[model samples]
Target chain A: MIGVFRQWLAGLPAYLWGGWGAIASLLLLLAGWEFASQWLDPLALPDPRTVLATLHGLLTEGEAWAELAITGRRALTGFALSLGVGSALGMLAGLSMTASMMARPWVTVLVGTPPIGWLVLAMLWFGASDGTPVFTVFVACFPPIFIGAMQGVRTLDGQLREMAQAFALPPLQRLFDLYLPHVLSYLFPAWITALGVSWKVVVMAELLATADGVGAALAVTRSQLDTAGTLAWIVAVVGALLAVEYLLLEPVKREVERWRTLA
Target chain B: MAHIGVTAPALELAGVGHAYGARTVLSGIDLHLPAGRIHALVGPSGCGKTTLLHLVAGLLPLQDGAIRNGFARSACMFQQPRLLPWKSALDNIALGLKARGVPRAARHAQARDQARRFGLDDTALGQYPQQLSGGMQSRVALARALVLAPDLLLLDEAFSALDVGLKAELYRQLLAEQARRPMAVLMITHDLMEAVRLAHAVWVMAPEPGRIATHFRFDDAPAQRSDAQVYARTAGLLDDATVRASFGLDAPAPAAPLALAAVGGLRC
Candidate 1:
């Protein structure tokens, strides 16, 4: 019987085993929260059970799904725009020292200015439309991606460049085959950071500038003094971020880096 | 082996020189490589041997002299294999043909055929450079160079890193390939014996604004030379005061002695 149980445990997916520690930590946090709720006002700090029930209720409602979809679209659109524009500009900077020097001040300014500042400007410029949230996300996420890609290109092996020249490979082939794959090692980490920022900025923008999406729903829950509902929306936002990271970003990163293990 | 008749001198260098900013690396170099011969450049480090190879291969611009290349195509094999880590051996070999505007299918087929000629089997051809052993990587690199069917082949200390057995096997492969075509080869090496074993003519170079110190031509075909003959020639060259001085052996030894080894002869 013990041997059969061991076999079943061993056969479990690695991620399931890996996540057990996180699961244990989460249970401990929930227990602490439950204890705190019993000691404090229920309205101020809802118990884990109450928050979970609120999340279940929100999941069943069609409005919650629509809001999630809207927020997801905004975040993704903004992230995509940032990736395209940032990588292009980053490559240009990487290729030319003069360009890198010119770009430094602009990158510093953008990075130094908080995401809230961009959110305020976006809300004023783009108004309470979908554009405001997307613009905010773009403004928040572009700098990291740009910096990562630039460093990647700058640090590419000089020997490989010499080899490419010796072979007289076409410019396009060199860019695609030699440069792109090498740059990806630097690019992937920045992309993950950008993705996280995109979700956060989009939600914040929605709460401040728009009348729809999870952030707007959270604002409504706050005004109504529904603490459980507010926590449920926070949980939903975090869940969406993790879902995109695991299902989209991580898989693509793993596929691209599969060659590394061989090396 | 089929010979493609090449009539003109494969490469001609006249008063070739190079400098970086204020520092001159090579100066007043003159050499001629006729078709269907292997020429070797022997020198200590910082003697501009690699710089001259680059100049001949057209990787470096002519700064102070004229280099006339009569060859239709030229290929270089560097000291390191320099194979794309991401690419399979077949793909790496096919890259040269692809650069010359060969179609994908034809280049791949040609690469596979060339791989077989280098004794790289189907399994090795399918593997990436990082997946292969050091010797296998070198074989793939040699295959990549020869697949171009270049009229002139430039090797910049290409076999210096390999063990003795692997080096000998590659030497035979290189000779056999040359026999199939009338390609002229220019190799750079620190080893005098290696130069003697592989080269029809060996040029000894001097350092500090590098220039050719001496040139020696051998009557014996490199692939056919016996161990005794190679050792005798090497011993004869080493005994000469001019050759020894050019190699910096006559002077008080520097902090680090130049590591030069004699690979006895071509066994294969």
Candidate 2:
């Protein structure tokens, strides 16, 4: 018992300090900002406590939850549609030179063109509602996922594929065992990239086109001259996004990768 | 009892020749791998030994000749293990069966059994190929090949990356496994002693559009090849002057350089 306790004590530095290091740094930055804002123009920079109080007010009134739900729905719907369409098109483009040639110029144009342009077009097409924001999210999310799937197919090992041919693996088995395993390294990074872009696009589109969601709520607060409320909504959006990533995507990613470490 | 009369040649190559553009790699290469026997194809660098192995495995097309085979199944163990990086050692081993439509439960059990036989513990079994040391990865690749019950196994320097002791151990296990299954193996190696150690017959390939330089049946010699005599004999063959001549070395110059016959020796 003494030996175990001694061992535990020896590991105390890592346990006590390692995990909290980032949090400590963040706290230090927040405190510095609070101090600087108080000393300088308080009108321009809100203190951390003021932000917290605004956050509390928004939470108590249940406004944050409704805004969160709207934004969340738009983000998920657009992201899912992007993933589905992008993966299918990416597969075709990657597998066939003709398809790739046909899609490349247009995809390049789409990727290069700014979101503001697409939002304008989407609003014109969809008449200033959820469709516009969702379309913007879809447009932002598709490129990364498409590039990932295409690259995954393009860079597949010929040797392993030949091995599958010799073994006479059925097409479905080949996809799951050979293709999917080979593609995951490329796919994971792409998915993570798409996740971030999806949220940003959804918020931007919401602000421009919709009268609901977090971005719309921020606009409303701004119109009412409630700067504190606007900041609170912005904080809520970021917090909710982080929570979704930590709770859903991260656990799924960890589970998917566990076999990789073992293997 | 195993029926000797009913046994078939696992692989047969006749007048096999291949060329890339104008540079020929193989020419008039005739060979046969009798069922259950280990055949060693030894050659100097760039001598089309690997080409022959590939041909027999049906990986490359025959340009000048044909190879007949009785084996229903074959597997190749490359110079590198060529394991899937995303798969665990156990899963990689089971991949061949999985691809062949074997049920998950049965395939895993068979793979696990082979893994244990190949001396991979559960911890090792769970690890990915990238996480494994070079030697461990090769063992996992070997386990993958053996689990499939391949009638013809084409090995291209499978044990080259391993240490001397590990090579010897794997060689023993391979010999034992071959005995049990009566599967034919064509192993390409630069190690002369390794050739003598495991093969029933050794064929030395000559370079420059390589052909069968010579064949040695070591059946008259002891099967257990730790003997000094076996090493001496194999070393002698490895260093033979004719084998050297094939590599454009130590050949007498022609009296007249214009003749087709003299230049034909240098022809690719």
Candidate 3:
């Protein structure tokens, strides 16, 4: 018990220093913005407290919650779809050269094209429904996960495979014992990056083509000249992203890495 | 010229030939591995000794000849342990059985049973390879190989990295375990003294597209030979003209000159 506490205490200074550094930088930026507003144009960049006040007012309104929920749902649904399809296809491609050759051109095209370009085409096909945003999110997220998984399986040690063969390990055991553990390390990072991009793309797609979401709210605020409201929605998006990263994905990543910790 | 009456041998490689691209690494190689005995394959580096071991383990397909096996299962210990860095020692040991279709509950029980025989404590089993000493990690690897109770075992310099005392200790442990259940072992090593101590029959191969140069059969019991005696016997075999030529050593003059030199017992 005492040892755990001592370890925690030793880590406290680093945590505190990081927190203070962020706060100090933010304060300096805000003070400069406020000083600039007094001397020159005020409409360019607002102070931090004004943005916080705008955030508080936005949180009290019912429409803001609805917008945030719509954006969140689209991101989750699209990310889940891409993750399932991408991982399965990636594994298949990794196992068979013919499959990889067939899929390589499409993977390259999908990853290379600008995501907004796809959103415009999706809007033309689906006519500005939730599908447009969801499809854009899928395109933005699939490539990284696919490539990571394929490379993970490809780069597995040949000696280990030979060892497995000599032992006559079944296919399932080969997957878990020799393959999956090696792949998971690469896969998790790709998944994390994919999820983050999916959220951002979903919002951008919603802003361009849809009538609902935080993106729509930002669009609405832009037309009305409600700059404070626009900043508040941006804050809300950032805060939610931070929450999901810390409370959900990071915990799962740590659990997957627990064996390493034991080492 | 040489015979051991090894009928019903555990493994037989008859006119085995393997080539990569245009270069033939092994050609017309014949070996008869007797059941429940240690056979050493000794040669200089790049003599295709490792390739032969891999062939016996069924990692490489027979290209031009036949390998008749008397055993169903074969276990291999690589030059390095080649352990899974992500897994604990016990998990690594259990991996062979898991691959062999053993159930999880039963595999852990069997792994624990084998680990205890290898002098591995529960804590040691729980730790990863990086956390264990080199000797301890090698022991775990040996346990992993032995746990499968393979009919044939192939080792590629399995103990060459250990200190002299530790290597001797591991040899004793391995022999004791083999005594409990007889296993046919084919090991490749550059250490002639080690080969002398452990091998019932040592087959020496020449370099550059390897072939069996000759063989030495130890007349003394493995338990009866001290390190010095083992070294001396192996040195005497190495003094043979063909063995010396393979290793790029200076060859003695002629049959009479070598016979006279042998009579004089000249030590270099």
Among these predictions, the greatest TM-score belongs to 1
The CAPRI class of candidate 1 is: acceptable
Give all TM-scores, in the order shown: 0.90, 0.83, 0.87
Q: What ranking of all candidate models by lDDT puts the best one first? A: 1, 3, 2
For every prediction, compared with the true complex, DockQ reads: 0.49, 0.35, 0.54
lDDT of 2 by residue, B67-121 (tens): 7787888877887788877778888999889877789999999999998988999
lDDT of 1 by residue, A169-198 (tens): 998888887888888888999999999999
Query: Measured with DockQ on alpha carbons, how good is candidate 1?
Result: 0.49
Residue B95 accuracy (lDDT) in model 3: 88
**What are the lDDT scores of the predictions, listed in order?**
0.85, 0.78, 0.80
* Candidate 3 deviant stretches above 4 angstroms: A1-42, A95-108, A261-263, B1-9, B219-221, B252-268
In model 2, the fraction of reference contacts reproduced equals 0.41
Extract clashing residue pairs from model 1.
Answer: none
Candidate 3 residue lDDT tens string, B52-150: 888888788889787888776788887777888788899999988887778889999999999998889999999888888888888888989999987
Best by lDDT: 1
TM-score, candidate number 2: 0.83
**What is candidate 3's lDDT per residue for A1-263, written digit by digit as tens?**
46545555665556456667767886797788678667744355566578788888777867667888899999988898888888767876887778777778888998899998999999998888889999889888999889878877777888888878877888887887888888888788888899899888988898899988988888898898877677778888977876676556665665555576764
Worst 10 residues of 1 chain A by lDDT: A3-12
Local error of candidate 2 at residue B102 (angstroms): 2.3
